[model samples]
Target: MRSGQTGDEAAVDVSGGSRRGREMPLEVQHIRDALRREFTSRISMADYEGRAGTDFDNAFLSRALAARAARILTDCSSDEAAAGVIDGRDDFGIDAVAFSASGSELWLIQAKWSDRGQAGFNTAAAHKLIHGLKKLDNRDFDQFNVRLQSLADRVRGVLGLPTCKVFLIVAVVGEGRLSEETEAILKEAAIDFGGWGRTVEHRVLNQAAFHRAVREDLAPEPITIVATMSEGWHSRETPYQAFDGLVCVEELANWYADHGERLYDRNVRRSLGLTGVNQTLVESLTDDPQGFWYRHNGITVQCNTIEQEFFAQRGPSKPVRLTLHNASVVNGAQTVTSAYRAYERTPDALGEAFVTVRIISVNGTPEGFAKEITKATNTQNHMERRDFIAIDETQSLIREDFRLTLDKEYVFKRGEIDPAPASGCSVREAATALACAYPDPILAVRVNGSTEALWEEGPGGAYTRLFGKQPNACQIWRTVLLMRAVRDALHDVRSTLSGRSASIAESGALLIAHIVFQLVGTDGIEEIDSEWESGLNEVPALVEGVLAQLIPLMDHFFGEGSYVTSTFANEQRCQQLVTGVLQALAEGTNVRDLTTFQSDIPKPRRRPSTVSLIIDHNLIPAGTRLEYQPSPTEEQAIGIWLRNGQGRSFATWVDDRRRPLLWEADGQRYSPSGLVTQIWRKADWREAWSAVQGPKQWYVPGEGSLVEIAERLWQRIITEEWSRERETTKDADS
Candidate 1:
């Protein structure tokens, strides 16, 4: 209805006839009814305006409408009053304010009733309400007592505190009119504004822009309104023609939280996936009757496809649009009524409406149970049926052997399946009987087939007689063949993994094979181990042989003979292998414990003495002299000479260029407590053999005297020859 038009201008006669001389009054009443109806229908939300008016008139008109809405709300005389106000200095834009009867409770609302307005209005309103509510919460944020009169001031404030209850409400009166979509929003707001174990009374007034007409009205009652001059939304379920107001933040938060489930249900119903809770009637019909039904967020008006489509095309003509389709049985009765106006009472109050449906029970044997049910009404009755009726009171009662079904003239919806025939036997029982008699013949496979004739005839003759009712032989055979192949393949994989041929040597392949075996072992397996090996003794044997070869090879090159040969050779080696094998183990265990090696050395009574030695000698007495000193810095020059001289100190040599005494010296020395082994010094060399050879070998050679060894040694002879040339030049010069 226009802002200037009276309620009479807004309605049209829904009833076909017009009363004599009552046209004007009727139109006025209809307009009033229409205005109320339209206002109520859209009370849940605000309408969408894609663009804002850029001109001053548009802006002025907007403000005017908002002011008018505020006036209407304030005039409502509800427990609360609401209005919209725009603060020029604020960036938050328009807000709505609601005041309770005593002006103690304040509800602040921020509205974005257009696409370009904002999605954060609800969030912003919630924040404001949360802040305001917290103020009323009597909490002290400054617990540190930083202020001079902190404790004292608080004590005084508490003592002087007045008895007052103020709740902050925030809500988003969404664009696009009040609708079921706002159901979730309302629930969320209720929870939030309801405050600290208490409930907040709230309502959302979703209205259209000034130029737009009220969409529709469907609320059960008029909502309490609070008017205030703040830029925000309104809370009245009734639409105030000029009001574009705000809702409380507490309202927004509560509505969001509570209605999330319903929104989720709606989205699930909108999709066609086989999964999800079957909450929607549409989904339930299309899905297998025995299959699970998915649930939707909310119960949409229980409707069939045709009625829903019709409403979609015509727009909402009533608060609820429900079409009662004839009669159907639920439990065991035929008391379903054809009266379709029952839903006019309320959306959530359908349970109170009386509905009659026929209920039928088909328990095997000839006799069955039939019932006429009239629930939500005075009369209800049931009785046994001696004979089944083809048409039972404009409804059909079809008794299939073991089951009974009741349905009025079948109305085929988009995804409805064909119903089972009205056979004398139940579908399952009939199928089972046919399968038994028609073991080979196709004609005998049908429900009403002749078993005797099929036995006399062949597959071709039986199939010819059966025609459309006969089972397709090709399809059956193919299905059976495929199943057998899959089963066999699964078994083969199982056999492979359990086979003795499963070797860890091919670790990657073996691991994959083992995984395959597990996947196919649904029925479980027997004789888990392969016949190839009863025990894993060979594995250890092979590992030992390989380790034996590697140990000696490593020892020879590194000059450490007992690296690791026998499995029990050393605890260190065993530990190394164990650590390698179980490296993936968590860091908590001690790695050294896995070793087999045990130390043979006794605990020290006293630390052993370690000694260093030097040997000084001359190869050619008085002509060319060779000397060895343990001058680590100078030892490189005389290392070989010291060793060959049978010099005991030379044993310390490791290499001629590095440490040459390791090959030659040996001795014993007495410390304060005991005798300790040491290398011989330069003083211990035997000078008697000085003239016997050119130079002594650093290492002990398998030979007797000096010259005897020189003839067998090429390196010694080369050294002697070089020394002679140098001496001749020195003597000639002298």
Candidate 2:
């Protein structure tokens, strides 16, 4: 190993001046030169990529490796290929996270790229990479990726999963090799994956290993099928040998589990769900395990080349065994799926069963013919359209602009970065932000999480619809910035509210922020990002002040939300709020000062959603008790204890008369039994809430219940009646 390992602390000067004074590796130096070439000219990522394969630096190779990782893990298609490189200063020791496709594998990468000899994978770099992963899950860093929050979320998602796997991968180019000390660190660190139920693996690839793996689509190995299938087995010759036989179920299961979707690389669809035909194949295996081959169609696996071996046990009772090499399943995917499932569901039964297998070589077949073979095998299965973002050039261009101009990364594509950021705007983020900023809140309200509508080539596709025509690079960048700023501000504000109020605020956070932005009207996009040439916007104060103005109103209209289908999360409800705010603003009403909350509002019932779902009321309920309680001197606090399980749902409200309504937003209003129902039915005299057998309890901020308040009212009414009677008696005596 030619790695430049150091025993003593490698001196990293405060000024980036190396005390060892060693000449830079030619790889790093060449990379620096390539970067310098860019500094002399304004280049987009597209232009850079167009030239990178030829004249670019070793950093380009690092980027390519990252992209390859994305493609492999995310199963990303070629046209919309994406990856991000944190290669500059303050990278905190990670070249990139080899993004995971799902909530399973996480590959953390430490890359060393050079043009000539090895770039050293020494102890210091190893320590940095290890330290980075340890803290990255918690996101305790200053110079982190712009998509840090979303990435943190992605990591948390995987960590929370039942069984997560983490891999520490080192990709080296040029002279550097993994030194013993560095490898030891990786080996030990690979045991831990930040939480319970995770398995970790570590790998270090030298220069030759990295290039070879890339060239051969991951270190080509001999994939030979060895089996004993003598029942009606034969071979014939087409352009390629067509071998038909009965293969075992256990073998297919093992193959599927080990290779996953990779085994069907050329197939149109891999492992389609339990379709009718697929179920039929599985049913046949379960019902008639003895004659399964005669009943079901066999699988078709194609390969570039195949070499077969045959052997016998050299006994009178023994049968011959055959095996084929270098194979990939391309057709009859559904049939393969059935075989794999049968093995998983009932291996005992499947072992007695046999499935037909057709192995064919496609070495001289045209690419079109191969695809046709794959498509023809599954004409009944409907194919879902791939997301248009895969073909979207605008997203790529915006990502390029963000990289070239913002000096921060924007992951337009999935798996572009490991642990997708919980915050940075994807095309969805961009669309929602643009729509929210579009002087119209309808689109934002309607298409928030609808990936198909939001990213496709229609009304919701703000990227294709608005880009180049209305939005420029500066606007797109600023929209992302402001949206993130608003989210951060909301997170800070969440600290102020009760755990319940905070939850409601969060559900409605996006809409509320859009409202605030609308309130703080922009003159133009230029005004929003005028300082794009310099630093960040003064977002904390701007966004927080707007949130402060909005939360109080939300508190009032939002009620014991525990049961309410989130108005904040619901589109119609969001539209309702948006319209209400717009109407209030139009009416010259001060939305921030709209509601006045008073304590001692009496025992309150849950507020029903009458009309206004955007008021700013307090969450105080009224106290229960009548005879013992003294005459009400002042408004105390509503103390109805909300018993709903969902922590987020609840709010305060008032009727048109300006009296504080005790109920959560329409809480208990919809039950078939209520005072209104009794009144409508003209039922017999009973307690005011005798009909409500199981009403959810709510919390009174300062103390109480609607029953107590009603008691107080009844007492007042009785006392007034007696006083009138006494006055009449006195008048009669006179």
Candidate 3:
């Protein structure tokens, strides 16, 4: 459809009529229908170009082959918009056109509908394609119909840009493997296209390859797996055949080059990026090509039926030879892709590289079976850190339950699109927070480092160890907020701590989450207190305040020396740091004046409330004082006061550090409390015996030694409480 004439001239359709022998494949026909349904020509090109908002014919210029070509563009390319169908008598050699969203890349496609039979591409098909590409190359769409004219105008700006990229694709429904001569011709044509101030990439896709691309997009139709079999090939009672043989690396690479990531469609975790595992595979394939077949696991393919072409044309070591076609690798994606990448990087590395293969052909099973195999095979890959938490039922429940209950989308799977404003947290984030917030400090530290172990349900399962009770969606959401707060705080503190790298090592999250857990008492409900919400909402300030104290404490503790382990998840170090902070808080010995640990020695300041005074004095029995009330958090140490016979009081608190002589005065300077036994020994005989009897006793003034004095004070208070209750009963009776 090329001529020197302008837009007024009619086009010469180079594409002959469709080969009229056979009907289109059912799959291909379905695709054509889908394309026409999804996007049809809304109006005549002349009317559309004229900008007349007229009624559309809808199917005015629908072309099945052109529709398929447009569909390929929509499916495979990024930033692509459907060009729809534009076939006409004067459409030149081009069948379809699509423009990149940014108008920087232009795709021109030529499609041949060979409905009659499977025909290999020859020089004639290649020449027609080359002619169409030349029309684009010469900017010679003069003979083009109104549709191409309209498309050309839409991309007129980018087309002239020196860096513009152009792609010319030739798609066919038959076995049109390009002759070597055709490939060379296209390559030379690509060079010529590049000379015209633009870069060009050429592609040719046959029916089988096209189907692979489409199926990979979602759940694809099962493909036919052609297998070469020896006399040993056998069929069991099942509706499938089994065969074993050598599969060549070259063959694998060819498959990858043809179908690409589609081969790995069943993998739960697709192309792990440039991860160390992927890199290791890549390295092995590149450095040890011949041995790669031995080192790597061969591919697992899914197919509808298995057919064999066996021969006695033995290749040296192998006694017989066979060829397989129409197969899709259901597993061993990393091995195949890495091998492909390796081959691309170093072609010479491969010398007769071949792998032993096992082919299982499914006859009656549905496509679901193949997908299940994919998922099962992929799940067996060496577990990554995320895979552990990714499926934790707690996390899954949170996401699923949240979505159902709150009417919001929650994404726990990787590659899942994040909702706006991040309506959900990653399972990893929730698990990490739960681990840190767990009641025990020992497990919290481990949770930070070993995410993979968290989901284990066996003995000492990390999931059970950290979180035995099921968590609610609301709690998970709150945990997400806490993590965000902690993350923000790390970012802020990083700037203040100069010459120190600003990054908070992932191991540090446990300590930070622990800090938050300590600050905000666990309410057990999913929602946090307003104060915590405020602090977290303030970004990292609350976290920054805690870090401000911790960084210094860490510096002082590790001064001129270092920890044996660099990771913050080092249990001993984490325990020491967290315990130290809690102790500092109990003694009122920190900065920033937080409501709880703001100062160096929190004082009730005012006289004890009248109710407390009654409990402390008149209500107590003659020689005993009141019992102490323990804090709800078994982990946090509550302040307690004890008085001896002299009426002089001593203060103490308990926490992970377990201070014996916790703090005496303002807590500015402190000393170790030694041991629980030593504190008990200070009390009188009766008081010491009492102390030995119950560890919860913290205050009971006037019992000789400090411990007894504390115990006596608590006893008096307990007595007052009992008297108050009796008085209230008397009033009720009156």
| Clashing residue pair totals per candidate (backbone < 3 A) | 106, 64, 34
Residue-by-residue lDDT tens digits, candidate 1, 575-694: 343333333222423333211221232321221111111112212122111222233322454445456656433233221222223332343222211110122223343322222211
- lDDT against the true structure, per candidate, is 0.25, 0.49, 0.51
Model 1 C-alpha RMSD vs. true structure (Å) is 43.0
lDDT for model 3, please.
Answer: 0.51
- Candidate 2 steric clashes: 64
Q: Model 1, which residues run further than 4 Å from truth? A: 1-94, 100-106, 113-125, 132-198, 201-204, 207-734
lDDT by residue for model 2 (1-734), tens: 11132323221111223521254554344444533442222111321333433234434555444444444444554322233344333446665554444444566666655444345567777788776665553233322433233254564444333234566666555544567888888777654332222345666655554444344453556565555655467766676666677777667776776555567767776554344345456656776778876765567777666555445444322344555556678776666666776676587887777677777767777667767776776565432222436566766777777666655556655545532453335655676677666666555544432323344345554455656363555677576667777788768765454323343445455666677567555546455446542333555555544444444544455433221112443455556567666666567466453122211222212233322221223222232211111112211211111122221124343343243332343433222123233222332223333334212122233233333223233334434554686799899999
List the candidate numbers ranked by TM-score, top first.
2, 3, 1
Candidate 2 residues lying further than 4 Å off, grouped into runs, are 1-82, 139-143, 147-157, 174-181, 194-197, 213-264, 269-300, 304-308, 313-326, 331-358, 361-369, 376-734
lDDT of each residue in 1-734, candidate 3, tens digit only:
21222221211122223532135566655544554454443222332222321112212222444455555553333212334344544556566776543455667776554333243455655666567654543334434544465565554444444345567776666665777897887777665544212456677767765555455545664333233333443334355565566666666666666666555544554333223344456656676767766666566666545544435553333344333344667667666766675677676665457665666565667667767776776666564434555656666676777887656556666667666546666665667777767766665655543444455565576666545677777676676667666766666554343211122222255676677676765565465343445445654554655655665666566541232123253556667888777777567675633222222322212334322343344433333433333333311322222233232133443222233323343332122223333333433222333323223334444433333333335434434654686799899999
